[model samples]
Target chain A: MQKEVMFAGFGGQGILLSAKLLAHAAMNQGAEVMWIPSYGPEMRGGTAYCTVIVSDRLIGSPIVKNPTHLVAMNRPSLEKFAPVVKSDGVVMINSSLIPVRSGRDDVDELIVPANDAAIEVGSVRCANIIAVAAFAARSKMVDLEILRECVKSQFASKAKLIPLNMAAFDKGLELAEGK
Target chain B: MAKVLMKGNEAIGEAAIRAGCLNYFAYPITPQSEVAEYLAKRLPEAGGTFVQGESEVAVGYMIFGAAACGERVMTTSSSPGVSLMSEAISYIAGARCPAVFVNIMRGGPGLGGILPSQGDYFQATKGGGHGDYHMLVMAPDGVQEAVEMTMQAFPLAEKYRGPVMIMGDGMIGQMMEPVEFPEDLYVPPTNKDEWATNGMDTRKSDTKNIVKSLYLDPTVLNDHNLLLKSQYDRMKEEEVRFENYNTDGDYQALIVSYGTMSRVCKTAIDEMKAQGLEIGMVRPKTLFPFPEKAIHDAASKPGCKVVVSIEMSMGQMVEDVERVVKGKTPVQWYGQCGGEVPTPQKVMEHIQSLLNS
Candidate 1:
């Protein structure tokens, strides 16, 4: 089985990092994974996105026209990528920034106030962590433990931020579970 | 070593290091700047030399200079940057200095967009610079292959004593994949003392070692050209590398593709297989040798009617494909050059139409 997830937002929204973390997690689980960033001439406020493809077998194509999941960190990303997601796939909406729904009744729509939750937990910088955690929890594409370990190691370079990110992770999971 | 997730550009830099190449000179250009960015930090850590040249032209000569001294040297650039380096590449090729060049190709005729493209196919396999010299070129489909090719390129370059290029698109440079570098792939630079300009005292030779491309004398220049042609002929005979997918039984169509574009075609072939349609593919790993025998043999299959060249450029490699097939089967070309990769669905549709025709 193959699953492709697209993480998209403005350039400074940590979109590429979130995708990389998920891809790393999937790779650690022995799945073939490819993380492709849209390395166009993106400025600070311009659109930036990346796709992470995980497969049981060798991944033939790194490019995915229709992803199995979309982690839209902003309204434009949601509006742009929502229509292209395959039916019955998971679409995560960052409710703090994006106010509209995916408007698709066939797929599972995940609504999480990632930015607000990150702010509540500690800093808004951890919003991507929150979004990915909630998405991983809702989608179950990867083990939550593996995803959590990936998150920790991602911030291993900055040890002080681990606790805040862990709190954000918990909050995201809690929010996704509707608690 | 354990597997690690790495961007193709970064992995390429590391691979060069693993191959014991100690010198790197390059100018940064997107979609491939990461190689220079990576080696700038890592090369120093490995007790190597890293120089960010003032320009790609200078970078090319930097490579030429180090290589002339028999040092394992390399440089990475994109399309326009590589264009600027072509002069030096020609000089290095004429002088028979072993060097590695990584072109993480971007779009264009001029200063086009910084996106993945196979637009440099003609320039790479055909001669980018003047004269009748071909850089031994390899096109890698993915990051793992990129690493292996980058590591192996050093030895291949030394073996040929000519420039060896790793031709990848911007996608290969930017994409991240898990890679475990093969152990024992590093072959130390060999046979350089005989001709390398490493000083007479160093080699303990009576004659001075001079590296030059100047052969103004007609008879002498013709002999040199013939010698180069003979080496290229040897390469064509010995170094042809390609992969055949699903070509075992009777297949209706044959695909000729390379680099990242081949991967998309593979996906299309796989999806079509489930629908009871069979298509086979020949992915050329070495673009220089052109995989002539492989293409000819694949196209010669009794069931194969039409051969298609799917590339990211506007029918560049298709020329080589058509030449190799030599009218045995009808050759078709489908591609895009504006940096938008042709999708697998589109490829499938094209092949389906071709079969119907």
Candidate 2:
């Protein structure tokens, strides 16, 4: 089985980082994975998106048009992607930014105040970590431990941000559970 | 042999270093410029030679000079830059010097675009340098393969006495993926006194070796072409690599693609399969010795009706696919050139239309 997820938002919102972290977590679980980021002109202040494919078998393509999961970090991203989510697929929206809900009833919609949750934890930059933690908890796509490992690896060089990021991740898990 | 996350270009440089290649000569080009930049720092640390030649033209000849000295040497460029290197590439092929060249292709008819493009298919497989010479072209779609193929390319070049190219696009070059370096370093055979014109002191007779592609006699040139053909024939027998996906079932259509385009085709196939359409893919890993036999076999399968060639170029490899299918399967072409990649939806629509027709 294969699952494709797209994380899209404005630049510096950590959309690309979140997608990569999920892909890395899937890879650590011994799954075949691919992460493709938007390149060229589309990357500068435009909608920066990344596509991640995680599969039990070898992944065929890294380009995903209809993703099983769509994580929209902004209103523009949610407006652009809500229509493309597959039936019964999950669409996670950052409630703090996006006001409207997904139009499709066939899919599962989760509105998490990712930015607010991150702010509550410490900083707004941790919003991506929060979204990733929520996605991991709800989708069960990858183990929470693996997500933690991915987070650690991503920030391994930074070293000092580990504790705060872990706290932010925990807060995200609680928020996901509350939903 | 632990996996480390590395950009594709960086991995290729590391692999080249581990292959015991001492001399690296290259100019900077986007998507693949990282390879030169990485080697600039890494090669010196490893006590190897690294020079950023003034231009791709100079870099190619610099490689020629090092290869002539019987040292394992390499150079890298993208499409437009590679066009400049073609002059030297042809010279190197004609002189029968072994060197590894990496082309991390960007879109181009002429400085086309910088995204990623497989449009150099014809240039890489059939148009290396010029005149009846074929370089072994290896198309690596991912970072791990990029690393492994680069390490393998040097020895393969020496084994065949010609240039070997690791052809990839910007996506493969710039993207970061996990790759493990090979456990053992490959030490190529020393041929300095034998073939290279290093010096004449050690030989029994003090004679100068001339390294030139200019064979004045027509018959000698014909003989040289024939020898190259024989070597190509041997390579055809030895080096066809491909990946087959979901080909067992009765399929309405088959997708033929390679490199980054193949990855896109895979996603399209999966989505089509979910919609109850049976489709398969034949992804060629080696472009030159064009997996003709595999194409033939795939076409011959029962219930395989239409074969579509998806590429980043305008119908270059499609001709080869048509040649191999032999009029049995209806062959078609779908492509986007100048670095514009065809999305999975576009590919699916093309397949759906073909299947419906």
Best by lDDT: 1
Fnat (0 to 1) per candidate: 0.77, 0.45
DockQ of each: 0.85, 0.43
Model 2 ranges off by over 4 Å: A95-124, B2-6, B176-178, B182-187, B190-193, B197-209, B217-220, B244-254, B267-281, B300-304, B338-340
lDDT of 2 by residue, B31-76 (tens): 7888998999999999999988999989999999999877889998
Docking class of 2: acceptable
In candidate 1, stretches whose alpha carbon ends up further than 4 angstroms from where it belongs are A42-45, B204-206
lDDT of 2 by residue, A96-166 (tens): 89989988889888778999988988999999999989877888899999889889878999999998899
Q: Model-by-model lDDT, in order?
A: 0.93, 0.86
Report the number of the highest-DockQ candidate. 1
Task: Name the DockQ score for candidate 1.
Answer: 0.85
Task: Return the TM-score for each candidate structure.
Answer: 0.98, 0.87
Report the CAPRI category for model 1.
high
